[model samples]
Target: MKEVKAFAPATVANVACGFDILGFAVDSPGDEIEMKLVDKPGIVIKDITGDEGRLSRDPRDNTATVSVYQFLERIGAEKAGIEVVLHKKMPFGSGLGSSSASTVAGAFAVNALFDNPLTTEELLPFAMEGERVACGAAHADNVAPALYGGFVLVRSYDPLDVVRLNVPEELCCAVVHPHIEVSTKDARNILRGEIPLVDAVRQWGNVGGLIAGLEQENYDLIGRSLQDVIVEPIRSMLIPGFDEVKRAAIYAGSMGTAISGSGPSVFSLCRGMDKAERIAKAKVEAFKSIGIESDMFVSKVNKVGPKIIY
Candidate 1:
């Protein structure tokens, strides 16, 4: 095949206690890319849509094209001509893993166009490179889940060890993106360079509990584990109405709620879709009360990550 189209789902990163290490995919608000092989010997980003011209088109600069370019280079196909068209259907800087979704789509599409030369797992590093370009850090929490689906745990970044975790069948997610922007860089920077040993101990226990809770399908444990002692206390200050939204979601039956990745978007996990929907509405109303507009999404955990669109 000379052409291929692919899609990758949006993701909620950090997952409360598992900051920079855990994430899960959602069903909607994803990104897509159409790629075609050509006789010309380089990468070309023919067009980008849904970003209001905010994203870069240069193959070396854009996350999507940069991922594809690096993939081609690794497979000794750098001389091969490829054209890409990225469609960003999600909100950028809303903590929904927008850049990761686009990068995964481009890498997944280009690999498919070449007849599946690389497995999904093998394409991860290339996608992470795109993240490095987008955020100055090649963190895998978002990209891993967006590429592999379901819940993911980044056990080690140096060795690039990643594990896909078990998600309860009834697990559902509610996300609300308030009309505001939070720079991931700024969020990370705001974190104190050092923390008390007591806080670190509490954070570690929560992370371990979260992983075990997911593996055991224990909803109560999951809810208890969704507390962030270090990051949220700091990063959440950047988002308006953060505490009110969290309280509203909890009152509406959310198992737990926290900043999705960096800020602006808050996410909650519930036992069922009904509760997820109610949580979404509650958060939206909470933000509205503060004179802030927001968008909401409710979905079960996406088990399938990127897929062929055409």
Candidate 2:
């Protein structure tokens, strides 16, 4: 059996206003997986790393392993018996698409080892099953960008058509991962079922503008459009120092700033690393100023998703 290696980057969902429908990738946050096809029937998970023993090898509890194996069973390839190992490059429950990145990498490694039995798009649902278990919501915004890369727009969730936009090379993102944990469930709980018509209109406008900004490479336009009247206001409350961090990012010349993936983690957009570094520092300081400790990732937009590295 041939050995295969696959990698996928973490994603930031809710990118401003397109909640559950929009996401973008960043460099630095990601996962890797290695797999080998075996002669035995059924898949067997072999190993894991970087998870600090928090992840499981059991199919039910293991996000990456379970998703890939179950998908194989669905396609009647369970007899192939794959041994897979996943490297968790990011923290679980970090709102950094940690599980999604692992799922994509593991799935791709297995699919590729077996000569790719499923189409790239077909692999989405299988991968999403992991998300379903992780977040209790099988949302595609994060996974789509983690798998496809660049700026992704989930046109429809039922069938999951993602439109990828060209991200300008100069675009930089500052991500602040708070030390505190906010489960996907708790974060979702804070959102209102129905928003006012005026708020909805404002959100839609921002969504349109974010999409346009990506296509046009307009930082100013993107910043203006990233505003949210509905989701952020509600979700922001869950994160301590949220308002301070956002304000600091903008003051530091960020084009836009918002919560990253049902977050306590907030991200900012800028045109250069220098600006991104400034933004990152400001966010960290904001968190500290409020007595909230956090870790920060200063990165640029990822143009590509899962791919072999080394």
For model 1 the local lDDT of residue 49 reads: 90
Runs of candidate 1 exceeding 4 Å displacement: none
Q: Tens digit of lDDT per residue, candidate 1, span 192-297? A: 9999999999999999999999999999999999999989999889999899999999999988999999977999999999999999999999999999999999
Error of 1 at 257 (Å): 0.4
Q: List TM-score per model, in order.
A: 0.98, 0.94
In model 1, the number of clashes is 0
Clashing pairs in 2: none
Q: What is the per-residue lDDT of model 2 for residues 169-199, given as tens digits with 9 covering 90 to 100?
A: 7999999898888777887887899889988
Give each prediction's root-mean-square deviation over alpha carbons: 0.9, 1.8
**Candidate 2 whole-model C-alpha lDDT, 0 to 1:** 0.83
